[model samples]
Target: MEGLVDINRLASGEAGRALLERVFQDDSERFLRRLRDRVDRVGIDLPAIEVRYQGLSVQVDAFVGSRALPTLWNSATNFLQFD
Candidate 1:
């Protein structure tokens, strides 16, 4: 399924976000490999795959409710367990 799954298309609702999270959690190595190969094939010497992977990981984490920050100041302090 080369080039079949567009990650952008999966950034919609909860289910799509969940699917993206699972994809990264399951086989992130393969995903990065394919991403690098595709980018290299296009003759683009952009950022390292590891760097891109880190950014993607952060994005996925936010979508999956892991890296989200509280909106209110009090809530932020409570969320972080600060005294």
Candidate 2:
């Protein structure tokens, strides 16, 4: 999708929030890599991205979803819990 998959397009309030949560929810490189791999199958040029954590940032060559982006969360919370 060229733009965001709006929260309203989702089936329900909870599902809509969940979908948004997943879109912004931070995960490991493994997770992002998997998503990128899936996007590669479609063969379109995915959006380039920069995800900043703490004071550090990494430029992702491509990403599968809209760049609606999200507010940074505390890293002290376990990544597993977010997953």
Per-model TM-score, in order, reads 0.28, 0.23
Q: Clash pairs of candidate 2?
A: none
Candidate 1 structure lDDT: 0.69
Evaluate model 1: give its TM-score.
0.28
RMSD of 2: 19.7
Q: What are the lDDT figures for the candidates, one per model?
A: 0.69, 0.62
Tell me the RMSD of model 1 versus the true structure: 15.8
Report the C-alpha lDDT of model 2 over 1-83, residue by residue, as the tens digit.
78966566683688787866776665565688888898899887977899867977677543234432342443323343447
- Which lDDT value does model 2 have at 50? 97
Off by over 4 Å in 2: 1-27, 48-83
lDDT of 2: 0.62
